[model samples]
Every structure is written in structure tokens, then in C-alpha cells.
Target: MSKTILITGVGKRVGFYLAQHLSKSGYQVIGTYRTPRPELQQLEALEVQLLQCDFYDIQQTEQLIAKIKANNSSLRGIIHNASDWLPDSDSACSISTIEKMIRIHASTPYALNLALAPLLQNNPLQFSDIIHITDYVVDKGSKKHAAYAASKAALQNLTLSFAAKYAPKIKVNSIAPAMLMFNPDDDDNYKTKALNKALIKQEGGEAEALRAVNYLLDSGYTTGQTLKIDGGRHLV
Candidate 1:
């Protein structure tokens, strides 16, 4: 039987790419989305199962997990890629924004692990993994994105905590990425600045992010760690 993986916020961008890559690589993918996106519909047509659930809604989140449990006794892995990015504005830098960011980025994942822990532990197949998708800015903090940085930092901590508590069963890890996707319209100077921030001196791509995921999946001895896929951006 093919292994099954669940990826939250798989309606577009990096989430969509991950779902596509995993599906093509032979894993059965269960992708969740808040609203219907055409690209996600395309994914479903390509054989990916779509589950609509808002992670920000605690009750709905729990219900979604319950449904997953009823349908499958085991899950190979979970990629927590859904995040709510507050606008980079003065008003969005307030406590209210921090609260919302925490709810979506940190609190929701914590609650999810709590609700799914039992199911994960009971996995008759016994080889499940949890991968949190965090931003590289969490390492060096962003001036205009304080809340975003803090939320991802909390997520990193959650990854470590889960790994310690559920060791040797469900391996928990994270990927900290920097500029995995760049705007095509961005000018040369803008791209140059981004490149200069990394020791690798290059912008990252979707393929690099997918490779990071594969690394975590294939490494049996790795857990409780965050892999940086930022072209060495943390060095700067």
C-alpha cells in the first residue's frame, strides 16, 4: 500500500507544489484548504484528495482530524504549511496581530498535535512523521514582520517539544526557508539584495523546498531539528 501524507494549506503556492511533488513521487496525499482554488482543483483532478478545513477554526480543525482517523488508521506524515501572514503595516504590528498570528502559526499546530497525538501513537503502521514549515526570518527576525517571526519561532519550539515527547515513534522536524519563491516582476536590485543576504548567494526555489522535505523523510536518524533551506541565509 502507498503511504499517505496530509498537507495543510495545499491550495496554492508552496503547499500546492509539495502536494504535487509528493503525489507524483507515489504517496497518497490529503490536502486541506480554506477556499477552493483552481490550482487545487487541478491537483484533485490529478488524484490528490481534497479536504476543506480551516485551521484557524479549532472545532473544524478537530473535526477534520477525526474524519481522517475514521478513514485511515495510519498516516505517513503531516506537513503544517498553512500560515496567516498579517500585512506589513503599523496597525498590523500591534498585539492583536500578534494574537492572530500566534493562533494560526503556533496555537493551531499545538492543538493539532494534541488532538492527533493519540491517533499517531496508535498508528498500527508505526512510522509517521510531522514536518512544520517555518520561515527563515524566524532565525534573524524581520523588522516589519515581528509577529510573523515570533509565531514561526514558537512553531520551531513546538517541533522540538513534540519530538522530545513522542520520540522513536513520530519524528518531528521543521524546514526554515528563505525566499523559496520570488516575484517575477521584482527588479534586479531587489533580487540582488535578497541574494546578497545568503551565503550561497542565490535565491531558493520550489525544488529546493521539496528536496528539504525528502531529506527529512529519508533520514531515519533525524528528529527535533530544523533544516535551513535558505541558501545559507542564516549565516548573514
Candidate 2:
């Protein structure tokens, strides 16, 4: 049987593309989306098992973990690709918003890894991988989305810690992308401003991110690393 992979936040964008990529690549994919979207509807057409879990809701998050435990699915990898990317002003990034960001990004990944270790541990392949979808702001900081950036930074740090603890049995890593996808509502001026951060003068879309995921899954010796597919945007 092909390896089983779980990718969270598959309603659209990178998570959506990654699910299609993995399913096409022959891995059995299980996707989680907070709400149904057209992309997820397509995934369902491809037979990707879909689960609804709003990580912002503690009860729903707990229930998702329970569902995983009940399935006892032989999962080979999990990609933490969920986030709340609402535009936040100084007044908007309230304590509750910050807490939700932390919970959705850091707390959920930690819980899933801890809860699912046993399935990965006992796998006949003897190894498993976990990938977190982080962002470029985690490298350079963000004024507008400080809460989101800070929470992702925490997740990046956890990637290091968990990679060590799970070593020889599981590998933990992250992919930090810059402008992986621009909001369709973004105007030409906004796109220009966003592209200015990249030395490559262009955005690397879901394809680059997918490449990193495939590498992490197939590379035997890589762990505890963050693959920044940011078009060298961190240089600035």
C-alpha cells in the first residue's frame, strides 16, 4: 500500500494543491478543511477522505484528534497547512486573535504529532514525517500581522524541538514560503509591493512548496530543518 498522508487546511491554496499533488503521486491522502470549498469538493472527487475540523474551536479540534485515534490509520506523514490569515490592524489583533493563531498553528500541530506518534512508530517502513506550513514573516517579522507572524515563529521553533524528540522514528520539519499565493482581490500595486520582497522578482507558487514536501518525505537524512522556499525574500 502507498503511504498515507494527512494534510490540514485543504479548502484552497497550497493545501489544496498539495493534496492533489500527493493524491496524483500515489499517496493516500486525507484532508481536513474547516468548511467545504470548491477545491475540497474536487479532492472528494479524487477520493481523498475529508474531515471537518475548525482548529479555532477547542472541542472540534479535540474531536478531530479522537477521530484520528479511532481510525488507527497508518499515517506516514502530516502537513500542518492551516492558518487564520485575516487582516489584522493594531486594534484587531486582539488577545483572542493571538490566542487563536497560536492554537491553530502551534497548539494543533503539537497535539497531532503527540497523538499520532504511535501510528507512525509502528509503521512497517519504520519512519514518518511531519511538515508545517509556515510563512516568510516568521523570518523578517510583520507589522500588520504581528500576531500571525509571532505564532508561526513559535511553530518554527517547535519544529526544532519536536524533531529532536521524535528522531530515528519520525522527522519533523517546516516549509516557509513567501507570497505562495496572492489574494485574488489584490490589485496590481499590491502585487508589486509583495513581489518587492523577493530577490527573484517573482513568486514561487504551490509548486515550490510541494517540491519541498516531497523532498522532506523522501530524504532519509533530513530532519529538524525549515525549507524556506521564499525566492530569497529573506535576504531583504
Runs in model 1 lying further than 4 Å from the true structure: 88-93, 124-126
Could you give me the TM-score of model 2 versus the true structure?
0.95
- Give per-residue CA lDDT, model 1, range 117-164, as digits (tens): 766676656467899999888878888788889999999999999999
Cα RMSD, model 2: 1.5
Clash list (residue pairs), candidate 2: none
lDDT of 2 at 147: 80
Lowest-sum lDDT 10-residue window in model 2 = 85-94
Locate the minimum summed-lDDT window of 10 residues in model 1: 87-96
Alpha-carbon runs more than 4 Å astray in model 2? 89-93
Question: Taking the tens digit of each residue's C-alpha lDDT, what string does model 2 give over 1-236?
Answer: 32888899999888899999899988888899998776677898888889999998889988988887787557888899988875455564487778888899899998888888887776668679989888888977887788899999999998999899999889999998888778889999999988897888787878998899999999899999989888877686
